[model samples]
Target: MVKSAGYKMVGGNGVFFPILGFASIIAFIYLSFGDLLSVRYKNEINLSFVERNGTNFVVDGKLFYINGWNSYWFMDHAVHVDSRPRIRAMLQAAAKMGLTVCRSWAFNDGDYNALQITPGQFDENTFKALDYVIAEAREVGIRLLLSLVNNLDAYGGKTQYVKWAWTEGVGLSPSNDSFFYDPSIRIYFKNYVKTILTRKNTITGLQYRDDPTIFGWELINEPRCITDPSGDTLQDWIEELSAFIKTVDNKHLLTVGLEGFYGRKSPKRKTVNPEFWAADMGVDFIRNSAPSAIDFASVHIYPDQWFKRKSLKGKLKFVADWMHSHIEDAEQVLNKPVMFTEFGLSDLNKGFDPSQRDEFYKVVFDVIYESAKKKGGGGGSFAWQYLVEGMEEFNDDFGIVPWKRPEMYRIINQHTCRLAKIHGAYKPVTGNMNRICNGRW
Candidate 1:
């Protein structure tokens, strides 16, 4: 009847024109939007998945669990240039696996380079890349917990970045307090919300706090301030940022980036980089550090690959138990639902010995599902990555992309519906931990 978003009409062949138009729409959807129909979302979660009561994510009258895998950073990068095919394949695979969500870092590796001209600028291309992903995933039936801003990997997570990031918390400095509280940052932040919310693609629906496709909008990836552990100032920054996002796009829940908690005997809250403190620093910490920030909580784990690894496969259940205990603690502390935004182990046998990857996957699934089933229940997770091709030897090869390491695929399949007849036994109790700091994810 009418054409907007660019449409032209040829009235002479109106009869056949409608047929052709309908067919084209069908083809486009079949090729890309098929999952919108095939997949189902039990429900979009509230900002409670990061909370804790007796268990984790026991908020908003829902269990709020997440079943996902990761992809390399999407925003502020050149996916159209680097890993297009892999992106498609990865999303397609997860759709088959019954995965409901996927997560990615949203900032450029240079988001903080003097705030000058040479880098980290947010623009059309960045939005375009993200637009592509939302479309692709929708076609395959997956939701997203896209985290904004990644100061942690500002320099590709170099040694110095790690040192500076940890010592100062990945947040902006007091001298640079204006960066967080500045009107400019707020404008850019709101622009980001507008970019995702207003730009409605077949997949990128209104980024409401409850849109299935837009599972959650997160603030910063693995944020850690350089100041106090109780980083009140940093937490205040989160509060302000959360308000900005909700004011514009109240359709979606918000979340603060977090790491799963620590164990009783775990090494001092340090990092694999030896520079920053692991995301979980304070005692039973969760959003207690960034309270009043978002609706959900998020964390990452690469213990086997980055930390000490005694025997992940053999201690699979133990590993699951640890995650359960830690996440539960987080929920209690933060009072929100949670998502294990990143968790991976390589079988490379280099630093921590790669043979442990498989078991790590099993443990991850067990921990996640078990966490979801219990009282508080689980939220979600994004395996380290998908399609980490040319990026091999780049940094952390966390892709579920099938290339050098076939194990990534195997492990993915093990937990996915493609081969769901089998299942891991020691499901963790992580979800029973608790809920949020008022953010989303």
Candidate 2:
């Protein structure tokens, strides 16, 4: 349930007057005196669990916009005592930049330091590391969006799940896609889900389902089933797992973590796809996201990877069109919010320049900002990834270390402040709200 943030004015003579007419005056006072209020009453106005309200997210009856970034390595780093500080640093940096959400992996299956050593077995030490991540993030007032698994092979993905099933002597199809169809594999995955949802955090002593620190649960990262281009295989998998997850823990939001490709069912929408082959990726943005248990839509943008042959200008155009199409579909067709869950321009591309990357980010941010201004289904985004300094081992072509990139940092900070203003929840930082709103921070 959403609580109202409305304020009232009472007179000494037992008379009352509506304060709605003086909104501008009240806003000025709040902004100017925010430092005083922040220390004393900020906790009183703190929002609880994020909730879906049509095409927007709300908390305490106020719109909650997502201006976030991904740090998939949080749990991986949190496991080591020395490296654990990095997770805290990253979250602190994100809070200073005004980011509200973080997307990271919750499942690391069958590998060194794996969260799940096998189908139902988990490492207690690794689970504690994840507990630390949640505890720290909560302190900074950031919510987490944790993915249950990965579609790719990195960090023990579907391949790991398939390998576990094979070792268990479950006679199944040789295809890795069987992870979605085979009954035994399905039960194994469900057991993992139930375990995660029911487990209590060691640090906070809060059951995973009851903690408002979690923004949502992503079923999988960039799920695709090329073996079944008809999309029925993936659609069925999403429906079943999404329903199962809801039954176990309905407090948090849930998304499919799709790359937002159009399939055979969306003939006209296919035109906006990056390539002809995208239509056969076995996951339709509309159909997969249409399940009753699925709360919103997820899309990932990687023009550099998708269209390696295109010039920078050509790639930028595709980025704009790709995002615009998905936003429109979310608003008009699905009537659900859509997040650009992952997007970045790789510096490794030939002839790549920081300027080019900046341009790409601007286009993506512009599309989201425009849609958000109109209260459309564009729910905001998380840049491909963020990293703290000295974490070079985890660095990829898309990794963003804000301190080292001043221009990119400014762009992200400006976007955060703009969205906060739109939500009417902007608070002054040390009584310098004007400076922050002007992007001077």
Candidate 3:
């Protein structure tokens, strides 16, 4: 039975009249596009993947820039009907701010409060929750970058996969790091890929695999094989898993999430950041992007994390150099489009102030815009997060809730407007791309 059946999302019309004007608009979008979703989505013409040609993202054969955010909590929060109004508000807020894409988690496989209860088993309620997220994003005209799994233990990621294997008597190493090499663990992960890829949304009646609103499928979120610093273990796993995903769903682009780490192969390149060598995650950016199925290269930067004791000025300079080196590598060596997929400074860091944070964002956004304008350096970026007013409890170091920090929101909106103008010059096949950003479309 479809759990989403007969359950109306809270931010819809008649029964739902929001106190906020944006909420009302969201209701209109939800009701207006209800059964005619596919037609409405196509009419908007925003459903194409931001494909890579040479070293830039092309949408409908024209250059596309990615001005987006990492809202990893959308699916997690939208599972409950009552909580959906918040999701609606956030997406509505993002649209208002001119964000073009969003990167979020598509997998929650683990034992403690897991989305997938066991291997080949899932909680239908949580699955329907994700269905609502995709449907709403389509309505709001924002594309998604959906990651399949997590490297960290926080959300039942690789560690949980290994635990499932151990319970089944696979008895691989006692370490979660072996998730990349263990055959049984790999099989379990592949099963998850097939399940999510083939899933038909309870709300839209479209297979997840066929949904063009999804910009791409990410194999994992920040994959690292710390146990094997040679980087071969992680590389082999990426090649095998990425190829497997293509077999399951050949439509969408695929990428491996790396932290712009330069591994041992090019010892000189590894010197780009001493922290890359010190962290010992064994990720070689050039070798990692060599797989045919991997369509684009991704990198994340956190100067605060890399140079914990550095002043704000030093951190900003590190960020500039970090971005330049990766952009150059993406152009010269990898010959693929590149994204500063993740980069942000946290408020919790020492010497943290609103002005400094704003400056940091400016420096990063400028790097991306400058690279993209030159037609090859950097494609786009997603700051650490986009949080809502009531979600302050989630405040780690990177959360940027627009209501609390209006200045940050202003900075983000400026980037959006600048990118929109640049996109207009590119003359995307969509024709009304400018109107799309201005919310007129």
Tell me, by lDDT, which candidate is best: 2
Question: What is the Å distance of residue 140 in model 3 from its true position?
Answer: 1.0
Candidate 3 per-residue lDDT, tens place, 47-82, comes to: 665677888778779888888888877777676565
In model 1, where do residues sit more than 4 Å from their true spots? Answer: 1-64, 75-83, 109-122, 153-197, 200-211, 261-284, 289-293, 304-318, 330-335, 346-354, 388-395, 402-410, 417-441
Question: What are the TM-scores, per candidate, against the unseen true structure?
Answer: 0.63, 0.87, 0.86
Model 1 C-alpha lDDT per residue in residues 1-441, reported as the tens digit of each score: 111111111111111111123343344436643644444322232222233333343334534455676664443233345334445545654554456577764444333221112222435555566666766555554567776655343423212223333354543433333344445455545565555555644334434344445666777655544434445545566777787776777656677665544322335334212123443232223433335546666666655433344555434654565566556654665556666777665545455544466667777777765555454535556777654333333234444444345675555544443212222211111121111101111
**Residue pairs in candidate 3 whose N, alpha carbon or C atoms collide under 3 angstroms:** none
Candidate 1 vs 3: which has more lDDT: 3
Query: How do the candidates rank by lDDT, highest first?
Result: 2, 3, 1
* Candidate 2 whole-model C-alpha lDDT, 0 to 1: 0.79
lDDT of 1: 0.48
In order, how many clashes per candidate? 72, 0, 0
Q: Which prediction has more favorable TM-score, 1 or 3?
A: 3
> Which RMSD values do the candidates have, in order?
13.5, 13.2, 7.7
C-alpha lDDT of residue 268 in model 3: 45
Q: Model 3 reaches what TM-score against the true structure?
A: 0.86
